[model samples]
Target: MALIQGQSVDSAVRNALPPRNLGDAERLVSGALGAVVALWAIRRGGLAGGLATLAGAAMIARGTSGYCPVTETLSAKPAERQIARKQGWRSAAAAASSVTIAKPVEDVYRFFRDVANLPRFMRHVESVTVIDETRSHWVVRAPLGRTVEWDATITEDRPNERIGWRSDAGAQVRNIGWIEFRPAPGGRGTEVRAAIAYEPLAGQLGRLVAQLWGEEPGKQAHDDLRRLKQVLETGEVPTPALRRADADAAMPDAA
Candidate 1:
């Protein structure tokens, strides 16, 4: 009788957990593919790269664990477990990076605080229209020829040190981020560090947390700061369009 009860308990537990769906051969192949894609994505550096990294990580997890939450969710009956379907803020991708600017902390702080100036240096930012002292509307370029727009309001403000914001309701992409300006060592300049958490896509919440916070932040954030440095020190970025505009202005216009 005791042996039968133990067997029954084992069966119940097995039924409760998601099934190990992949065979050994399939798992090996999947893991290999994931490693390759992940390595390539890390080197690529950008939004596309970040997305690929997440995809690779999912594949790796599925291969090694042999348990796929996504597969489980699709096959799950109403009576089955609900944990596979649960998604929380922790699922959001997060990243951070820092750069030193050749400018005073207060000046760097002011530039970032004026959110409208973001488009001047932030590469993917199409525009930022100030709605009020603490609110703004942002339009940004997404992968493919797509654009995304959102309304956000500043959540925290410190005179010349830090600033933070969060997206408003019904945003296409939810965003929570902050920037800090600190004095650099040896009086060199200000050191700026930015950290952000956001749902990159509308519902891609199953991505791995480690991949989300990986090298992406350094690449994207450093690029933004590099452009900002050019703007702050030299007054403009030398992009192709700007170069053409500069060349034409010296020639002629129908004005």
Candidate 2:
């Protein structure tokens, strides 16, 4: 019987309205609380108690119907636009890092081009599965034991030069990134430049959570590049044990 603005009184049009944002868990919890309150009010057995019971019953109905008038009223267009802007800022976030490795450009390029090798130096990456010649599936570890997966297609590939990739549609975390290899001056080694842009799973909130846990993306990229350099230079990533051994060996023996 309710009429929507600029619309006819048809069931089909009414059904097409935006769905309630309340998740299943929220509905279940609200309904349970409302039922308990309603039972308590009924036990009081008076005129005021009757009004309280009706209110509680209304709450149960709202939860069951997946419609909260207060929530809908608060989620007006202006609030929606503000949320969109926040998410957009997060989606456009990016980080870049560069490192010079004591290895030839061809060798470095070949190592990176093989996506499977990424997990060796990328601490957050759990695995990278090659789907085909130009496609790969990546799984990265997230906070609280969560893992995010995405399929990426190679957008650009030039042997010993550069490679670029973008995630496919519906990816859990949308992303695009590129890596370039250049010969260092005097053929000393390869200079690798990498950049990535991604939309965090929970947008800015997710990023802030990561930063709070000392896992910002920029810091991760910097450390990953350092690990890559160490791997290429020494055929192994440097560990605390290695550093300790090196320091001990450098110290003169106490007489």
Candidate 3:
């Protein structure tokens, strides 16, 4: 019959198509759940139950094939799908932090304007290579000895006031941020406030995991600013060992 031939052709086409989405663990879980639901629906024995069973079977097929129709419909290309995922994460997990450095606004602004100086205080930054006046490449440490790299372009620059930047597309992690330097009251120093928002390599879930492990961006920013304060004040970052040695040396001899 024509109907039987059409069904055979459909089967052949389905088998020939490559998987469009769904990771391995997702496939396994979905397959197992679909199998259970299909059996349950078939046992119910009704018109609605029959439809449910069919739906469950379709889900199982999708899982077994590692394809997700919904995602496939949304994005035909793998690269676009990955980009969508990064954008989603970037929108979901945004964080900000600020600090006050005991230095003049001009001094602090100049220090930050030179992106190369970031690694001196930022623990995770591996390096920043300046490409031009407006563009630079950055490498930062990631979990498990991995690293993330991106090219960023300066968006806004105001002398001794603020600087803003955003990463270029296709970066390992999309990021946008700004830093503001304001003169402190009573001629004390500069109030240096830095804010950064980024999507981690694995998205929001990865950020959550990092936070649970005490490696969150907010924590890093705070620590980096603290180091920056130490650096600008003393021209060096004092380690705990160094502080302890200095304390011992300063103490008078006891009987």
Candidate 4:
């Protein structure tokens, strides 16, 4: 959302043009790398060193200023590119997850359709409060015991099939997400797919940092789905204590 805005794809393509498309976490990463490279490059004091210095500067600007014009045409997919243009979204990070649950497709869809149910399975989602039929308020846990609040509007809804949503105006974190539920091949249960695209902001960037430290969104999404399955079938969600006890029970016995 922070990327190049107010540009239409049909107008024309420019070689280098964009806005602050990077986030805090991205900037930190790029800045750190650039610093290392420049420090090393400066010692040589020649043409190759100069080129490396330029590379380091580019990386620094990418993270610090959050602007990377090259991304405008990075992976231009006709249809998806058009959609991103129309929506004013230039996201840099995305995640997708899929899971099969032992519940009917309709049942799975219903659970996801109700925003209030998300906190139960999604460990980081503090709560989702309904505002109206298509609008909802969300509070999500962030790093360092922080939290971010946002309002989101449902963009698409197809019974027992799909649902899509995006953050409303003035939201601190700009995000777009979707969920799909389909019948399993063997008629066993529901196959669910979920995806999210978000721009890095002060609040959301914290989560990105955490992602790098082993709690990536894609992995978390799958864990949430597993919890959802437990909720639906066993009416039980695995707790940390329970997992610890189980691990202890499974340990080898001394001879």
TM-score top scorer: 3
lDDT of the candidates, in the order given: 0.77, 0.81, 0.81, 0.78
Judge candidate 4 at residue 70 and give its lDDT. Answer: 52
* TM-score for candidate 1, residues paired by index: 0.60
The stretch of ten residues in a row with the least summed lDDT in candidate 3 is 72-81
For each candidate in turn, the TM-score is 0.60, 0.61, 0.62, 0.61
Candidate 4, position 10, lDDT: 31
Q: Which stretches of candidate 2 lie over 4 Å from their true place?
A: 1-90, 241-255
lDDT of 4 by residue, 1-255 (tens): 423453544334543545566667877999999998899899987999999999999898787777765543243335544545666755334568888898998888898889899898898899899999999999987655778899999999999999999999988777788988999899889999888766544333444565655555567777888888898888779899988998999999989
lDDT of 1 by residue, 1-255 (tens): 999999999999989976797789888988999999999999997998999999899889889888876554333233212222332432355557888889999889988898989999988889999999999999987654578899999999998888999989888877778998999999999988898766655334323322244324345677888898888888888989988888998996678
Error of 3 at 164 (Å): 0.4
Instruction: Assess candidate 4 and give its lDDT.
Output: 0.78
The TM-score measured for candidate 4 stands at 0.61
> What C-alpha lDDT does candidate 3 achieve relative to the native structure?
0.81
Q: For model 2, name the residue pairs that clash.
A: none
Off by over 4 Å in 3: 1-91, 244-255
- What is the alpha-carbon lDDT for the whole of candidate 1? 0.77
In model 1, which runs have C-alpha deviations exceeding 4 angstroms? 1-25, 28-87, 202-218, 240-255
